[model samples]
Target chain A: MMVAEAQINNNTINLLEGWEEGLDKAPEWVQSFRKKAADDVMKTGLPTPAWEDWKYTNLRNLESVTLCEASSLHVVPNISSPFIDLKPIIVQLFNGSFVGEMPDLPDGLMIAPINEVWTNDWFKGFVSSLSIDTPMEALNSAFLNDGIVIKVSENTKIAEPLLLLSTYENSKDMLSVMPRIVIILENNAELNIVEHQSGIGSYVCNQATSINLGEKSKLGHYILQDNDRTQGYLFNTTKLNCYDDAVYDGFSLNHGAKLSRHEIFADLLGERIECIINGAYNLISTQHHDTTIKTGHFSPNSISKQIYKGVINHEASAVFQGRICVHNDAQGTDGHQLNRTLLLSEKAEFNAKPELKIYADDVKCSHGVTSGDLNDEELFYLRSRGIPEIEAKQILTKAFVAEVIEGIKDSVVRDIFLSISIEEGTK
Target chain B: MRAQLGRKKESNYKMIKIKDLHASIDGKEVLKGLSLEIPKGEVHAIMGPNGSGKSTLSYVLSGKEGYEITSGSISFDGHDVTNMMPEERAALGMFLAFQYPVEIPGVTTINFLRTAINSLRKARGEEEMDAISFLKLQKARTAELGVTMDMLKRGLNVGFSGGEKKRNEVLQLVMLEPRFAVLDETDSGLDIDALKVVSKGINSLRSAERSFLVITHYQRLLDYIKPDVVHVLADGVIQKTGGAELALELEKHGYAEFEKNQSNGAVA
Candidate 1:
């Protein structure tokens, strides 16, 4: 395995100099957080195949490309909503920097760019609360280019979902961006958040979302990342902390980008918490997508479900690794995972690894995986009924991934995802 | 005279005429020197024991994969159709009800039927069925086939009972309304009631303008279908051609005598 310590160290040192120059914009502690996080990342470096978790995904290509840091100068690219009829509440970000215009938000909702509200006591306390760090989480905090914070007050149920769109406009250079997000829902509050990424040029989008759900609160987090550039890179890390009787639903669809990975972690800290994490990847030629999910059941009587479906097209590859860990005292835990892959061509490949580490005796956990190309009998059955081969392929492929798409609770968002993914498959 | 002319209208040349079809799967020959013809207004039943190549003959005509016809000619409605795709043959009004209807997960039965009918309509240069008309058409046929409304919303034949699967196939037969239909072992795993329902569905489509080729191992389905002509197939060729009485005779006596005769003929 090639070491990326030197490659990452150079970028971290350069970013530190930039952070010191803008010390007033950020507080003293934010600067220290950046420096300390950078040092931690420099020590650990990028993950290689030697690590069991990163076995199938290679980071050699990512480490070799020394992309430039994001500049403050922002230019909004012309991006229309893919869902024409759905005028969702939109929060736009350019190159990891917020485009701070005002939109009318409902009561009990507060959304502001983290940099603009860094001095608030809640922001400072929430930012400095966590101490333990993983390599990717440290890397995100070290070179944090921009961030957002959304706090929903207690007993509020928002009607419309908030869409946070981070677009990397026509890049003059190969840029690298790290966007951080923190969402906190108070007791009995409910909120749905959708994170979207779109761009036209070569760049690396590395971001982390940390969510905290108070007692009886509900949260749904969705990530839709589409980058068609062959050399682009996108990696997202989403972590959720759930309290008693809270519900958390996280879903992601990695439909574009030459290389992309979404790592999701959920911690069920209180009883009766239920979380469902489902995802799908529609990959094309020479593209690689990896989805890694882990859920820890720390309290008794919690439920966790993970389901993923991927279609690997010609010369494309995908990987799914899911693990459920039940602690010793976490009895009555139920965890189920199902991973399915459809190889669209002879050259496409899909690999799945599902694991369960349970130290409790009264837990129920199971995992299963299936992967293959379209069934010949099914195709012939359709063709024998008068459907042309082209249309037959489209129908069968769409049907193959429909089970996962139907997992999304919202009908409008479901329709948009369905159309985009089917369009991508047909092409 | 009017009824006769009505039958003659669709039988421009013939409903189906297959000559000397020699087919194989995976280098193993299944059909050798098989020939048959069906007129527009007749129902033909081909009965044979196991491995007698009855299903292979149906598959070759329907253009299924893995059944390669080395030397043959298949004519459908006067047009040579040996090289056509499955969809093309279907567009020409050829339908095959599979012995094992494929269980396609996530495809609703109603959606599948609509797509199939529209594609065929498009091929025939006819206007596609609108949603309202399609719903009416579907509800009427599904009600007759004893298919519940809930089954239409579920995946096509997935997790269905064997009787439900056969009913679904018959429902497709009712919806497609092809010029010629091939029912391959439609009564294989059916009970008496299911068989009656399926046979009723098939009987409803009987007309002077349509023909059927019922392939079965036993004479039970032939009893319900009442074919106009019956052929005893053994070793890939028709050993005997007779009226519907041939089915009763075969039901009384097993296929052991026919196998001996075919082997003796080959030896001679």
Candidate 2:
């Protein structure tokens, strides 16, 4: 391990040496977090196949490439298909650094840089209470320059969603972007958020998002990552802390990037709390996508349901690993998880591992996963009806993905997601 | 005899002709040079016992995969349809209702029907149907078929009872208004009430321009729809063809004699 770290450090010394100049401008707390995170990252290093959680995704290529701190480029921002019609407070992060334009946010909503929050005593204390065990989270905290910090006021309802857009524009340089976002919804407050991360060229985007929900609060969160064909690595971890009677609905659609990993952890702390995680990913060519979600039921009468659907075409690959941990004290817990995959081509691959760790025997918990191709009888029936083979396949694929997309309550976002999925599926 | 000959001439104007069809699956022959013609403006029932290639004929005519047509020719409305794809056959106004309708988990029946209708219309060089007109037409057809609007809104055949799936297939036939339909054991799992409803829907779609090839193992469905001709499929061949009484006769006599004749032919 020591020799490996030494080799990695020697190979990536040029990538790690440039941050000293930027440290002078960062806040004191940001500098301290970065130092600790850099040290932890050096000790832990990039994950290997030996790690159980990352066994399917190989990060050896990521270690070989020397990463450079991404800077603000002069490229114009392109808004192709806006998923929703809400007038969101847009906070744009271009290549890991904040682009200095902040939209007029609603009253009681705080949209500021992460470093700015580190300076504030209240938010600093709030973040200190949350767990940050993963090395990626530590790295994000350490290198965090300008990421969005959303603070919703107590009992306030936000009419529009908050849009956090992370774009990668500079491909001429090998870039590493570590973006951090923290959203805190107060008691009885209602909010909707859309996080969009996309890049044009080969880049490494490591993002960490933490969401905290107060008592009786309702939140709808959407994550859309559609990047270019260039080799890209994305590490996203979303943590949700729910209090009593709070309801959280999260939908994630990952359609791009060469290799992507999404980790979500939901801690149901309060009684009567309900959380729904719905996701869909479509992979083609040689792309690889992996999603790992864990929901911990700490309090009694908490319910969480997860459904993840994926379609892998050509030689692409996908992985879905979901775990539901119900504590002994958490009685009357009703948790169900289902992962279904449609392999469009024989060469494509899908792997699903659903685990249920229940300490309470009284709880109702179940999980099922199925991987298969389109049904021959169904295809024949459609063909017999005079529908062409391609059209039949398109219809079947659309139907397979519709259930997950329809889980999104927002019509505009659902429509956009469905249209994009259909367009990409046919292509 | 002269009236029968004239009726045959008129049937030739609009009918599907299957000439000495031979189809196999995984090298096991199912349809062994079986041949039959279903004339327009009439309903024909093909009743057979288990392992009698009743479903094979339906699949082969629909151009389903895995069923290799070793030697056969199928013509629909004067066009050679042996090599046509499923959608092409559907665009030609041909429909097949499977005994076990597939469960499309996420797609709503309404959306699927609209897409199928529009696809067929587009293939025929016709403009797309607007949502309002499509819904209006669907409402009338579904109401006649006794299908609730909620059924149409749900995922196609997902969580639907057996009878509901059969009725939904009939609803599609009514909506698409196909010129020819092959209903393969549509009444297999349906009870008497559902059978009557489904049969009524099929009966309403009957016309001089449309034809039906109803495939079933029981004679009960024939009692409801009444076929112009009844054929017995035995050992991958049509062993006998007669009027509606033949169904009642086969139902009472069973297919033992036909099976014996098939084995004798094999031995010869």
Candidate 3:
């Protein structure tokens, strides 16, 4: 008992108190990875406000919740998706474990559990190559129990999007879940994926996804985190690698969760590649959100663009930290980033740190950050047209986020996002 | 040539009455002790130089913020709207055609018009216009206003040319069918062809129940939509009132004569 108390004191906050025993059931390779991750986490613990990247987000709510590992969840909970009407193939991941049978697939497409694919050479190589940049990522790696792996063969084009719907619900003991997603597209392949995450109770969900796009490949990745607004805490890490002539267009919509931190790291590995990342979030009450991005331009003639817009109301606060690094060999690289937020209440706050580290002289890179209340001119214009004041504000707020949603290339996906954004942003 | 053939004479019923209108912006008085009246069925023009409070009067009448009425009252169609909100004033049939129409991105012009029309209808306890009926009315109004349907597809006044913006305002005036409209420098940026199209659209809305206050620096617009009375506004007050010929006279002599007379009268 004395040693346990001393260990807790040394680790600051030990989330592995009740969740460490079940991790032994994972495979040998994952067991080793988990061993190393556990050691690293014991040394570092979770992110705190002292960390520069987490300055504005405090984990006070997470420390009080007693989290335990979820048992083998075989019973499929009846669940519906936000895009259920679109009829896409829905793959469910309950309590960080992929459940249910694999849906029908077209030619050259593969989907399997990570436990089944851990022996594959490419899967081993990919898992070993992951860099743990933060304690949350280490926690995800440490407790890596069950996940999914999706691969697209060369020259394959998917007709319909695949929805990876992850749901976590615990009414009893608060659960901590870790889910990993690995996606790889061969040369000249194309795919669209919509990742939706949600939960019910005060659970801690830490998820990581690794994506690799081969030469001339195209991917449209959309993510929506609509967890329980008053309870859940989510930490997401997305690492992307792009080859020559590949395009990775990604957008995230965050309007849920009591606290969320979404970190993205994109590595431009090959020439003439294009990476576009855009996001829009609406936070109300005491909700807090953070988006931290790091894009490395390593090749010549690559382009990267990031645009984020959010509306913060009530006592909610949001943080945006975006950094673009252009290496010496990355000549002719074009990078742009912009973050604009609208504050609906005087107590609402937005903190932004936009940085550009360029060693290439010929690169064209710029960033901008703006935050303010709704434009009085815009509000007055709408009211002058006989719309009531409250309705006028709603219209302007909806319009503020319309640009990000409408920029989506796929019409169906665009419509879904547009409806959600309009609904949440106006409210 | 002034088009006086369709001009309506002033009636006994006053549609709008501005009494001793002393207003200010940013604590600096702009319209001091100014008074004007426009009876039903008649169109009145208020011509003034830059900073003569013509725009202030229009904004104040339309209930825009930042303009405080020090001590005056504005009544439109028998409703005292001094403390009313902008939308409330709009519901009372008061409209101001801005000199610079604001650009609202992401909202299509057609959507804006529909919302405005439906809001007005709802405010008056009428059922909102159905979509099909709105489209039909929009088709007729666009045709009458000489505005292309393509312009309505884009964001409201976003990327629109100066002429297109003025025409859109005129299109809105026709759509809303307000009882009182203030054309604030509606002809400032319009070229010859657009000026004629916008004036023709405004002329089509002229009725015995409607009134207008045309505020302009030049008399070019009065040539197309003839006003029954033209008032010379200088130094925050109306100095003279005359027939349609007054506009042509101001156009020829300019506000220089009015400024000189006002300064001379101030010295006395």
Candidate 4:
């Protein structure tokens, strides 16, 4: 017992003490990954504002928040999506466990818990190959138990989108859940995955998703984070590996959560590939939101563009970090990134960092960062036209950030973005 | 050549009455105890040299930024408009055709016009106009001005040529249909053809219930849209008042005489 206590850090020990138990039924291979992740957390620690990557954000409750692995799950409450309701296949999970039977899926598609599908060599290699770097990601891998496994067979295109809602609620006053999601699209397969989270408890939900797109595959990924933010915290990570001719388009609408960190990593591994990552966030009333992105161009003729806008008001603060790295052999690569922020009050703050590293002379890569309050001339002009002060501000702020929503190609998704604007922002 | 006319005989049918006006911008006095009165349905032109407070008077009337009226009483129609906001003044039928129209990105001119019209209508508790009717009205208003559909589709004043911007301002004036409009140097950057187009647009809006205050440095525009009264403003006061013939007189004699008189008066 003393040696085990010495092996893992005090933080991980506290993480394993509550909920009356810890990780129960994960396999030997999974256990090995979990153990390594815990030891790594002991060696390094939580991120602080001093860290270069976390220069503007701090994880204050890493040691104090009462977090225990969700060893047991309760009932699965019924919930429906607010957008894209075309009778699509639905999978529901409760408190980090797959609690209900899956609905009928399209041909050549399968959905199951990770334990039931780990026999596939590719699946095992992918799960075992993941290495955790940060504290939250390490926590995700260590206590991770139940999550969805999606497999889309080669050459099949699903017309309708697939929905996955991970709902967290229980009688417990505090809970910590690590829900892992793995999506595998075979060669030339196409699919749209819509993932959402909602809950009504003090739960720290650390969610992670890994995507493996085979040659010529296409994936449209969207995340809806509309949880009970007053009593919950959410940390999310999405990793992408794209093959030849693959296209990965991702958009996230962030409107809730007390403290949320969404980090996305994309690696363009094959020739003639593209990746588009765009999102918008509205932080209100002391809420804090941070989005960190890192995309690498390793092969020739690959393109990646990142655009994100944020509106912060009422003592709230936000941070956005975007970085693009191009290798020497990626001569024909093109990378573009931009982050624009609007502060609606004197107490509101926003920070942005855009980094570009290019070793190849033939590559074209650029990044821009800007943060400001509303323009006075624009305000006066609109108000002078008899528009009320409130509405004049809404029109100006909405126009300042509407370009990101217009970037969406799907009509339904675009409408959904318009409906959730983080409140025209009260000063 | 026509005989000159002075300020119309004092009448009870007044549109704008300014008494004991003293205004400043950035702590520098511009308008010092200036006063004027414009009767309804009249087009009065104000002629002054550079830094003579011609633009300041226009801005003070329109409720623009950076101008403070330290002591003044400006009555529009019947309401005391000295404390009204810019939007409030706009709702009360006041419009300022900017000399340098601000360039706003991402807002199209069509959308701006619709928003402005609807705001005014909503203030008056009138129903907002539908898109079909708005487009129809816009087509009729902009048809004779030679404004293309492309100009209306672009961002407000963004990438527009100087003449195009002035024409756009006139286009707004026609759409708003205000009771008292201030055209501040609207003729500064226009060529002869564009000037005629702009003047025609403004002229089309002239009605017996409407009044206009046209401020200009030259008399060229008066030839196109004749004014009822012409006032030579110097030292923040009207030093001479006459008819449209006064504009022709100033064009021939220049503002040298007015400057010389003001200097001599100061020395005395």
Candidate 5:
């Protein structure tokens, strides 16, 4: 334990020194946030391996790298093949800084940087409600720079999704970019948001996004991370705050990156709120992917459902840890979580831990996990019908992954996800 | 486009010939040197009692797992194909209608059939079937089998009843058009109506280019799909080989004498 503490302190000192030198080109507000973030990083160093949440995903290698500042801002970006053609309220971030091109504004949708409203009393109070217990979340708040802030007016519905694209170009040196975003939906409003993270070369990305839904509001959010093989480390922290009768649906699909971690936390504060979380990950060849989700039902009569699936091939590894907590006061809560994994190679590995901690006696909660290969009887049946071995395996794998993809409401995005998943499964 | 190659002389010869075949599953010997021959342009029925190794012969011929060939060989179209992968045997135009078909969740019937047909076509050096043409052919075949388009849209054998699953097997047989088919207890769980529908589909595919080995425990299905020869499979061996009247004899007298004879012979 002492050794782990010492290593974390050393990493914090290295990061602070790098931040002090890297903030010269950043904005004034960003520089201020960095100073506070560096202080917090020192106070809360690295998470230990014994930590229950980080037990399956090791961060030893990520802490040792002396990441530099962003140096690829001058390079031209290839912006072709944007996912959707609609004129959404687009906010493009290039290496943690806001770009100039903005889309046409919608009637009830407002898009701006979080710093623009940081001084406002109402927004400041709301930002204070965010959980800063974890070091990663604290670091994101301390280094808070230019992340998009979306606001949906009360009783309004936006047909087009709000698109946020975070792009990382190849830097001349080893660099790390921390992008933080916050979203708020007013009472009785409906909105959809998609966060797309992509990069061209090796770089470390640390992203934090917070969503607060007002009373009776509905929010659908999708996170897609598809970077190049050269991209090294990714840490994403997403939190949600739900009110009475509010609905939150989120789906995450991860396809690339050498090492990636997605951590989600949801706090259901009001009665009768509904939340659904679905995710799928496809890993191949030395890639390490991790997804950790936790939901706390603080109020009575709240409901939550989660399903996460993974397909690991070659020497890749994936980890899924899901936990649901129903407090003593949270009676009549209903929750379920299921995690399944398919191992395609002998060397490939998968670790799944789904936990349900219910202190309320009147709650109904259950969790299950399974890991195995394709069934032999099913394989023989297909072969007896004239399907070859390789094609049979491919077909079975595609069907396994389709369970998660079927939840996507958008047809175009669903098609793209299916095609990419099949291609990866066949390969 | 590649032209269809000339049909080889072996295609005209008797397609499936079994001679003194001995097999077992889980160390329990099932087929005790059972011998039967299915010549081209003819369909033969094998009627037997329970634990008669009728299904064992079908599994051994198609190369199913856990069934070891202790002795003898199975020749298909002049080629020794006793030891081949299930897909390899299928690609060589050998089809087996399982008595209890396995359900493959999430794989649509249309998609599976298209893949199977294209794989066989590709193996024969023939042009691949396009999507439109394949759909047109599938619709005609499913209609002839009395299966609706909705059944084909669902997962293979998922939520299907006993008769529906048997009809699904026949649907594939018609679509694939295999040279030699082994129906392993295909009529075990079917009612009169389903049996007639299944037999009608089977009879429609009868031709000089194809042969069938129908394995059943009842003589009722044989009444509909008439057989050229009837063989009694008792104690893993062909106890009696006679005309179609042999089925009536077994249906009436049962296999008491056959079992006694095999037990006495075992003691010697």
Candidate 6:
């Protein structure tokens, strides 16, 4: 195999300047962690297309774009309430920094800046135990300045969902904002959280979210990224760890960002755990989005599922990479994955790769992938019913992605995702 | 021998007329210069064996693509619609009850009906119906058809049985209230009960200004939906025409005679 030595190029180094100021006031361990991440970045550059996993994406695109660090000036936009009827605890983040007054959270729940919890033993241990897998994640850890930490005490079932609304705006030449979030739910706890990212100006939002679910806990996680398509890039990574009898349900809707990649890694470390990762993307106008997920079943009687669907229009492209690994001890594991995409134009493209590594003989695993245009029979049926050609196409396209959104277990959240998908798919 | 009829003077009563309509699919001719005419306020039934181009005729009438007209014209309500789209034909008060209703997995049946109704209204320059009004109308039309309100909430014909699909089509027919309709084997998979419900829906819409072309393979449906005329289609052309008795005769004797005559290139 021809090996291309991964080295940080000068252009990438130029983007990493002015990082010391952000880390000067951080705790000693945090500073060392950032320094080690920066050293790794200098030794091994950002991922190039030469890597097998990133063969379809090229980091060189970020080199030409002048992405300076986000300014200290806090320019908060007039944001609107979420389009859901259920009253949620709203937390707004401007340019990756937590802004606005903190709401009165319910008892047994805490939401604070990440730095505020840095001194706590559990939070410190969690931060120190993170092992960087990709160069992009290393870049995030190296320059991370602002983020929030959410924790739910044991046996606490929060009635309202927590909405993390992050908005970004670049006043100067393209800006880069790296935000990290950590969520911990103790035993027998349940909580629902949604993160929405939207902004106007050109910027790169490189963010990461790590979730730890204790035994008998349930967490419903949702990410809706509807950033400006022409002026932004998003790289979001989610790392999840589930203990015995823990359930991690996650869904993502991506219709924004000129280019984006949402990668997820879930570790079912204890028995009887359930992990569901589902998402839908509607892209148009030369936009690109990638969804990569890896689930490791280390314990028996665990279940994992991944369902992703996309609609690619006008020269837009998308990628879906799903990898499921069942260890020898993970007997009685049930894993299923499916990916489907609709290419609306001749120039639209979709690439799917499904990898399954099974070492357990008693496990049940299945994966499927399909990519095509709309069905002619279905289209003709709608048109014959007096629906115009254009409207018929839109209806069918929305229905195509709506099938995936239906996998969302929550009805209110499903409707919110459906409305956003309908609005975006029509475009 | 062609069943010839006397030509009538052009009047205000709109009719569907096909003149030497020839259509082909994939370079093979399926409708070979077929011609038929149905005046207003009449129900005509066409019976044929398999591969006799009955379905092709229905598709051609609704302006489905991939079927080259080759050399012919189709006109409805004094308007030339040979080159029009399926939706255009629908806007002109034309409807087709498909033999097999398509299953749209995520679009609910009620939403589909509302969209169709609103689109037709827009095309006709009329006011669109709101949700409440549309629901009231739908409830009224579907009340006696044995279609429960729960079916409307489900996806369009997604997991419906054969009878349910046919009932849904009849429901659409009643809701749309088109001036011209072509029922393409609507009785193919339905049982006796569904046939009556469908027939009732069709009979309710019969008026002096509306016409229908019912395409069927069996005579069972004709017992419920009485037709004014019956035509025998064979080898892509109409071979014979008679009164309602013709459907009974075809059912009793089978399509053997028609098939024999079709091979001989005979028209009666």
Best by lDDT: 6
Residues forming the 10-long window of minimal summed lDDT in candidate 5 chain A:
A1-10
List TM-score (chain A only) for every prediction: 0.92, 0.92, 0.94, 0.91, 0.90, 0.96
What is the per-residue lDDT of model 4 for residues B15-38, given as tens digits with 9 covering 90 to 100?
A: 999998998777777788888898
Worst 10 residues of 1 chain A by lDDT: A11-20
Candidate 6, chain B, TM-score (2 decimals): 0.93
RMSD of each: 3.6, 3.7, 3.6, 5.1, 4.8, 3.6
Taking chain B only, the TM-score of every model is 0.93, 0.93, 0.93, 0.92, 0.91, 0.93
Identify the candidate with maximal TM-score: 6
lDDT of 6 by residue, A1-427 (tens): 1224765775468556666765878888889988988877777777777778888876677777786767655545567645445589988898888888889999989999887878788888997897688766777888766899999999999999998888888866788888899999999999999888886678878888889999999999988887887878888988899999999889888886898999898999999998999988988898889898999999999999999988888999999999999999999999999999998899998898999999999999999999998999889888888999999999998898888788888799888777764445312
lDDT of 6 at B4: 18
**lDDT by residue for model 1 over A1-427, one digit each (tens)?**
2234444444443333343345456787888887787677677666767667788988777645656767665555556656434676778888787775747999998888888888788787877876434567777787654878888999999888888877874456667778888899999999988777775578777778888899999887777777773768887888788999999877777776888888888899999998989887788889999998989999999999998888888899999999999999799999999999999889998888899999999999999999988889999999999999989988998888787877887778777777765545312
lDDT against true structure, model 4? 0.80
In CAPRI terms, where does candidate 1 land?
A: high
Error of 5 at B46 (Å): 2.9
Better of 5 and 6 by DockQ: 6
Recovered native contacts, candidate 1: 0.84
Candidate 5: TM-score? 0.89
Error of 2 at A52 (Å): 2.2
Off by over 4 Å in 6: A1-4, A421-427, B1-14, B261-268
DockQ of 3: 0.76
lDDT of 1 by residue, B105-216 (tens): 8789989999999999999999999999999999899889999988998899988999999999999999999999999999989999999999999988887888899999
lDDT of 2 at B197: 94
- Which segments of candidate 3 are over 4 A away from where they belong? A1-13, A18-22, A71-82, A421-427, B1-11, B261-268
Worst 10 residues of 3 chain A by lDDT: A1-10
What overall lDDT goes with each candidate model? 0.82, 0.81, 0.85, 0.80, 0.79, 0.86
Model number with the top DockQ: 1
Q: Residue A331 lDDT in model 2?
A: 94
Better of 2 and 3 by lDDT: 3
